[model samples]
Target: MDLTLHVWRQKGPQDKGKLETYPAKNVSPDMSFLEMLDEVNDGLIKSGKDPIAFDHDCREGICGMCSQVINGRPHGKQEKTTVCQLHMRQYNDGDEIFIEPWRAKAFPIQKDLIVDRSSLDVIMQAGGYTSCHTGGVDDANAMLIPKPTADYAMDAAECIGCGACIAACPNSSAMLFTSAKVAQLAALPQGKPEARKRVLAMTQAILDEGFGNCTNHYECEAACPKGISVKFIAKLNREYLKTMIPTSTDA
Candidate 1:
């Protein structure tokens, strides 16, 4: 297949970027999107042209590093699939695809398709942890948790921090990502002690990092690769309130 690519190119963080055109030809329908990008880079290298830069690692779709806005959709409009998992067959031969980095204040463009997503790292550092001191592993049956709660926590924990939620929202909200990280830890008994501090710190960190607030937009859930629900925001909100409320003993 032959395709036209309008890819964003920037020299550095301080440099402005523009869409530069390149012809992608003979692309196999089975080739993953990143693989097609690899072919394009190989062609550029052989021709003494600067190659396009994009984030990708563990092309198996586990890493969530392949963050790109393809044809105006994060991860190329495939429901629940990452950019690394999208195949060439999704597009027609004469298609003109536009690729760009995630657009958000917190995610500044490094160059080309790469952005400084370390803000997400900062959010993770804010919470999303179990600080129990266990020198040895405990039996799975040692704690009795309702199966439904465990399942819900596991689902939220599936988030990979790819920033699709922010890209999909009109105001570029990071609530979905932050909520998921909070829920993952706030579900279990080991997490109960820190639940109050966790949500407080994480939400404040998100605001401090310049991410926009959620205005009841469902786009974050729609674009989420893990299909993490916006209800996690509600969960986080409830947890946030707990921080201000007195504990049972004090009450």
Candidate 2:
């Protein structure tokens, strides 16, 4: 199939960017979206033009590094699918595709289709871990957790920190991503020790990084490649509240 790609190009973070069109001729339906971009880059290199810069690590969709906004939708409107796994078969011949990077105040563009997503790492570092040892692997296995609780923790853990949630939000909120990190640990027994502190620290870090607050638009849930639920946001709220109210043990 042949197509026209209007891709955003910027020389650097300070450079003003614009959509530059190129013809993607005779593209294969089996080609992954990144593969198609590779083909386009190959053509540009042969013509002595600079290639488009995009983020992509594992093309298998596990890494969540392929960050692109296709035709105004994060990850091209495919439910629970990342751009690296998106295929050309989703498009038709002579289609006009608009490609851009994650657009959020916190995710400033570094260049063409690449944004500095280290803000997410900062939030994670604030508290998204269990510093307390949970003993060895076998010891952890010996602790019998309720099946439902384990499933809930695993569901929240599915988040890949792709920042698609932020890109899709009207307020550019990081709540979904942050809540996933909080809820994953909050639901686990090992995570209970730091639950209160984790929620408070991570939420503060999110605000410090200039991420907006969640107003329940649910766009983040829709854009998540892993289908991470907004229910975790509710869990985060409960966790935060617990931190504010003194418990009997504290008394």
Candidate 3:
């Protein structure tokens, strides 16, 4: 199948970018999206043209490195699928694909389809962890957590931090991502010791990074490749508020 990819090319963060058209001929239906890109890059290299720069590692969709906006959607329109997991069978013979790097101030363009996502790392560094000393793996019965709570913790822990939630939001909010981090720990018994501190530190860090507040558009949930629900944001808000309110134990 033939495909025409309109890809954005930029020299640097400060450089202006424009869409460049390239023809992808005979794309196999079984070929993954990154494999299609490899074919395109091979064609470019043979023609003495610069290849498209995009991130990819562990192309099995386990890693969130395959970051690109495809046809007005992050990771294409496939539900719960990353770009690397996207296959050409989803498109037709003459389909025109528009590809671009993630557009956000915090994730400035590095070159072509590559963007710096280190701002997320900075936010995580600000306190997305529980510093308590967890002893070596104890027997399962030792920590005795309710099954429902453990399930919720794992549900929230599914977040891969792909930034799709941020890109899909009209407000460019990181609430879903932040909330996922909050909930994964908040629901766990081990994390209860620093629950309030974890909530406070992460909330402030995300705000300081200049991400917009959640406005309930729910685009974040729709765009998440992991299907992490926007309900996590609600959990975050409640948890953040709990941090401010005086509890008998915290007080």
lDDT per residue for candidate 2 within 87-194, as digits (tens), equals 999999999999999998899999999999999999999999998546655655678899999999999999999999999999999999999999999999889999
Could you tell me every candidate's TM-score relative to the true structure? 0.96, 0.97, 0.95
Model 3 worst lDDT run, 10 consecutive residues: 125-134
Error of 2 at 112 (Å): 0.3
Give residue 15's error in model 3 in angstroms. Answer: 1.2
Q: List CA RMSD, all candidates.
A: 1.3, 1.4, 1.4
Model 2 regions more than 4 Å off? 134-138, 248-251
Query: Could you give candidate 1's per-residue lDDT for residues 1-251 as a string of tens digits?
Result: 99999999998899988999999999999999999999999999999999999999899887989889999888888899999999998989989999999999999999899998999999888886878876898988999999998998899889999999998889987899999988878887888888888998889898899899989979889888778898888998888888888888666
TM-score of model 2 (CA atoms): 0.97
Q: Which of candidates 1 and 2 is the stronger one according to lDDT?
A: 2
In model 3, which residue pairs have backbone atoms overlapping below 3 Å?
Answer: none
- Model 3 earns a TM-score of 0.95
lDDT of each: 0.90, 0.94, 0.88
Where is model 2 poorest over a 10-residue stretch in terms of lDDT? 132-141
Look at candidate 3 and tell me the lDDT of residue 215: 88
